[model samples]
Target: MSTDKEDLVVDDDFPITEEDVEPRIEPAKTNLSKRRTIDNLLEERRLQRQLADFDYDL
Candidate 1:
């Protein structure tokens, strides 16, 4: 069952069925490439910082 709300409009000829009135999950991954690039950059910076800190600690 869908948790989405639908508008209650009075239609005398409206047909109701399980498949007819159901919302489906869209198989979409929006902005994944951009997100991955940002994540990789952040991870690389973290590794570089860690290496620098290790050299200073020694």
Candidate 2:
């Protein structure tokens, strides 16, 4: 669902042009593209294994 809001008004002589409306902008990415270190990958794998372990109380 989009959270953007736009107003719709009915006008006979309304001059519609591209300059009147704001340009659609893409969200900027915060993280830069960089090669991952070996230690970082190993920690990620450890976390994934931890989450995969399931314990039932039944």
Candidate 3:
């Protein structure tokens, strides 16, 4: 039993080819803008709720 590094055998067909992989797709700009708008609205509502729940008495 030899523990040499070069003892392993690599197959030529084992490497991945360009055709076998799928291209990465990015989200549309409109969708991202809409998400940002929704996020801002939600944050504003949260802040308003926090302000309403605060006690003003010393």
Candidate 4:
């Protein structure tokens, strides 16, 4: 068992290209918008539940 650095072997079959490394902006924006919408809906629902549970006699 040799611990030399030259013993490492890399496979050339799978190479990283520019398209694979580039960031996709449009999909990310849509996903973020959808996530925000869901978050807003959840917050609204939670607030409504709290309002329904409030003690009006106080």
Candidate 5:
């Protein structure tokens, strides 16, 4: 379906501030590759658990 341009918002009710941004940390150059691989493996495991009907009750 075609949408009207008026449906989009142009105003920024609550503008983002500098404090809202988290401080960046510089990672060790040698550790960067290993860190990314580990992160990817962890994400894969989490997704597999979800697909297998695993649940973490509150």
Candidate 6:
């Protein structure tokens, strides 16, 4: 048995896409160590933004 191309798609120029590229993302972030890592990264980003804002205001 073989599959047909026309049965699969409406247009070649544009194709439908899914909301999630990763199958299971929430489970990966649920770990305690992973959450802590994310928190630290966010704090560093916030500190950098504050410094940049202060420099522009002067």
Pick the lDDT winner: 4
Candidate 5 structure lDDT:
0.83
Model 6 accuracy (lDDT, Cα) = 0.76
- Sequence-dependent TM-score of model 4: 0.55
- Relative to the unseen true structure, what is the C-alpha lDDT of residue 2 in candidate 2, on a scale of 0 to 100? 75
What are the per-residue Cα lDDT tens digits for candidate 2 across 1-58? 9788988787789788999999876544422222345568888999988878846554
The local lDDT score (0 to 100) that residue 18 gets in candidate 3 is: 98
Per-model C-alpha lDDT, please? 0.81, 0.70, 0.88, 0.90, 0.83, 0.76
**Candidate 5 per-residue lDDT over residues 1-58, each given as its tens digit:** 7565656667878878999999887778758988999999999999998878865663
* The 10-residue segment with the lowest total lDDT in model 2: 27-36
> Which of the predicted structures, 4 or 5, would earn the higher lDDT when compared with the native?
4
User: What tens-digit string does per-residue lDDT give for candidate 1 at 15-56?
Assistant: 788888668655456467668889999999999998877856
Ranking 3 against 4 by TM-score, winner: 4
lDDT of 1 at 19: 82
lDDT of 4 by residue, 1-58 (tens): 9777686687879978998897866787899999999999999999999999999998
lDDT of 5 at 47: 94
Candidate 3 residue pairs that clash: none
Query: Judged by lDDT against the true structure, how good is candidate 1?
Result: 0.81
Q: Which residue pairs of candidate 1 clash? A: none
**Per-residue accuracy of model 6 over 1-58 as CA lDDT, tens digit each:** 5665565555657655785355565665478778899999999999999887785644
Q: What is the Cα-based lDDT of residue 6 in candidate 3? A: 75
Off by over 4 Å in 2: 1-36, 56-58
Question: What tens digits encode model 3's per-residue C-alpha lDDT throughout 1-58?
Answer: 8677676676777868898899866678877998999999999999999999989996
Clash number for every model?
0, 0, 0, 0, 0, 0
The alpha-carbon lDDT assigned to residue 24 of candidate 2 equals 79
